[model samples]
Each structure stands twice: as C-alpha cells, then as structure tokens.
Target: MDQLKYQMVIQWSDEDDCFLVALPDFPGSYWRTHGDTYDEAFANGKEALESLILAYESMGDNLPIPKVASSV
Candidate 1:
C-alpha cells in the first residue's frame, strides 16, 4: 500500500479565478482547480492531492515525508 503523510489546504485564488490548493509542508505540491463554487473546489483539491500521491508512489522512488512548514 502507498504510505506517505501529507495534509491538504484549499484557499481561494482571485487571480486565477479558481481554488488554490497546497500542501503546506510539501514544496511544489499545489494545484489549481475549477468548480461551481468554493466548496466544490475544496473537494476537487482533495482528489487532486490523492491522485498526485498515488502517482508518486507508483514511481518506486522514496516518498518524501513532510516534516514541517517553513519560509526561507
């Protein structure tokens, strides 16, 4: 089974006119999704994240575990 730890955060993106989803500690893990409303965007973001995780796991490479969030 795929085993990796991550968290999802969905926020509004005015510039994109879509939802901006991010994995706070997973750098470069983000996606822009469209939906009828904000709530749908959040839901879509979750699915997008799940798909990404699965794709990475299928690569047979070590899954990077997120430890903490940072700004540098």
Candidate 2:
C-alpha cells in the first residue's frame, strides 16, 4: 500500500515527555502511538498505519480517502 498517501502528525508532548503520533486519515484514537524520540515515533506511526490498513482490508471495509495538500 502507498502509506505516504496518508498524513502522519507527530508532536512532542511535555506532559508525557515523549513524541506522540497520530494518523488523521485512519479515524479512531486521536493519538495512536508514542515514542521517546522523534524517529522512534515516526517508525511506530508507520507500523501502526500499515496495520490499520490491513485490518480495514481484512474486515472488507473501504479505506479512507487520503487527503492531499492544495496548491497555494
């Protein structure tokens, strides 16, 4: 699957003292995963997104349309 088509939002949380990752296109929890560092959060987010796609496919559900950036 083309994972890049989806958007991944990563932000650092001072309360958690870690980086939080969110897959806005997947539709579920606001924050899907977290990591101690930015790189780790990115890797974890990618894995979570791939798993979500497979889960949706296995359940015979249509995947969400990826949002694209509009030209300014």
Give the candidate number with the greatest TM-score: 2
TM-score per prediction, in order, is 0.59, 0.93
Clashing residue pairs in candidate 2 are none
Tens-place lDDT digits, model 1, residues 1-72: 335556667776788776666666444635545555778877786677676667777887555576755798
lDDT score for residue 40 of model 2:
100
lDDT scores for all predictions?
0.65, 0.92
Regions of model 2 farther than 4 Å from truth: none
> Worst lDDT window (10 residues) for model 1?
25-34
Give lDDT tens digits, candidate 2, residues 18-61.
99999998877889999999999999999999999889999999
Instruction: Please give the clash total of every predicted structure, in order.
Output: 0, 0
